[model samples]
Structures are given as structure tokens and as C-alpha cells.
Target: MEQREGYKRELYKHWNKGLDAGDGCDTRREVIISEAIKAPVVTAGCKLTGGSWLSPYDGVTVSDAGKLDVDHMVPLAEVHDSGGYAWDAGRREAYANDQGSPSTLIAVTAKSNRSKSDKDPAQWLPPAADYRCTYAAEWTGTKLRWELAADEAERQALLALAGECPTTTVVYGTAP
Candidate 1:
């Protein structure tokens, strides 16, 4: 209750910081993926209720947990390299486990997740072209929330991917 809220508030205060005083710059995809698979948060529907597994990567539906991976929209490695080396472990863990936030912790296919392993937008992309716009918004939103900076190549790639989808003003909520 209050204790949880307090911790959340504290973490949010230093939300921009990540593991190992920012040295935890690598996406740590293996560790993150392994942990997420152990305890997955259900996906939400358009209205926010728990919905069936819908992978934005390939626009496929899968009910089997083994088939999914909880993707970090703004990859851990990218953040670590960008500035995560300065953050505390708690902040990094929260960012790693962020799920209540919209489009932050998506359940995508294992193949897609593996394909996206530790790479920024410049290195990987969704197979479903239509989702690129939403994906960019989600990625940008996470980075903005964590006060993270994107590499020049990643920025360019995101922009290019976003261009193919319908335009919408991107907005991110306060840190939880």
C-alpha cells in the first residue's frame, strides 16, 4: 500500500538512472528475457483489459507462454550505453520490469524477440510494417520517460520506420 507507493515514488524520482551507476549499458537481453518468461504480465486489450497475446512484431496471436517474450521497448543495452551506467540497480530493475505502462512490456513472438535481441531500432524492426508507427511511439515514449538519449543511427531508423505508419502525436505518462 503506502510502502509500495513510497518505493514507486522513490524509484520514479531517480527513474532516469539505471544499473551499476550507468555501467549496466548493455541491454542484458538474456537476463531480462529469462526473468520475464518466468513471470509474464498479461497483455492488455485496446480498452486496457487483459487480452490475448498479440504480437506487434508480426501481428500474430499466441496463447502459449513459451511462444512469447516481454520486450523492453527501449532496450537495456542502448540505455546502459547511452547513460544507464549512472543509475542504481533498483531503477534499472524497475525499468526492466515495467509492465503497467502502455506498450512498454509487450508479449511478442520468441522468434521476433530473438531477432530483436539487444538491438536498437537501427538494428532490428518488426516484420509487420504496419506496426512500425506504434512501435516507434512506444520506443520513443520509453526513452523519454527514462530520460534516455538515443544513438544517432537509432534515431534515424526510428524516424524512417515511423514514417510508414499513420501519424499521431506521441505522449507518455508519468513514471510509475
Candidate 2:
């Protein structure tokens, strides 16, 4: 557990790069995706964090990682489309590595994450009726933290979905 914690910390450091959480403006997908998969097994032996088998997407309980995916809060394509391409490999890697952080990553149902693959909120959403609010806030928080941009449609979609989870204390923060 100690070793795992150490690795998570290192990974977080690599991702953060001393930049404030919301400073990754104009990120490119080419750079981040390459780095995103480098730490592919961060939660190998660990249980999923935030929301669970009771999927916020489908409302079904997923008991295993096979049923889930560590989704990038800001999809890679969106990152690229926004401007990630101009970043150095290290920053890209760090953005991809954002998984180790609390606000940019989520262990969500395979169906939900896949359904949302590289898509902005305007393009996809969780099927679970109760999870939309948390989902929206997370989506907003992730984009804001990374300084990722959203088109008018995407921004509206997020605002609408956030109406579902009205609580403001969803615990968006750094990873342990």
C-alpha cells in the first residue's frame, strides 16, 4: 500500500508539473493521450474511487474494473481540438497523467465511459438519472481545472446536467 501510494504521488507530480490545476489552457490531444496510457494500472489492485457498482450512468451496479474505465474528464480529442497539440510531450503526459488527481479522473462504468469516449458533454451523458448533477459538476470542474475549453453547446449541456446533482460538496480535490 505504501509503495502504491508513493507511485500515485509521483504520478500526480508528473501530471501537475507545478502548474496550478486550472492552468492547462489550450492542450492538444496528441500530446496527452501518449502520456495518459503510461500509468495504465494505477488502480490495478485498488477498488474504484467515487461512485460505484451503483453506476451513475446506468444505475446498475458494476462490481469490477472490467465493468469500468478510468475516463479522462476532458476527453483526449477535445483536448487536441482545444490546443493540446502545441504542448510539449511532458505537459501532454502530465495532462494525461491527470488521472492521479481527484478532479480530472473517474472510475466509471464501462458503458458510461465508452459512451462518453472523447466526447464533450454536448455529445454524451450518463444514462443514470441520479448521477447527472455530480457528473456535470465533475465535467465542469475538470474542464475548468485543466483550462480546457468548451463550445457553447457543450457548456450548456453541462449546465443542464448539473441540475441533477445540486449538492456543492461532491469532494472534488487531489487524489490520496
- Which is the leading candidate under TM-score? 1
- Per-residue CA lDDT of model 2 for 1-176, tens digit only, reads 00111122122223232233343321222122223323223233232333223445667665443455656777666765655545456666677656445557555567777787777778877777666676777777765665566778886887666665566544454322
lDDT of 1 by residue, 1-176 (tens): 00111223223232222233343322332223323424334332211222245677998876555566666676566667656556687766777666546555666788888888778888887889878778788888888877777878888887776676556557787665
State TM-scores per candidate. Answer: 0.67, 0.60
Worst 10 residues of 2 by lDDT: 1-10
Clashes of each: 12, 12
> What overall lDDT, based on C-alpha atoms, would model 1 receive against the true structure?
0.61
On a 0 to 1 TM-score scale, where does candidate 1 land against the true structure? Answer: 0.67
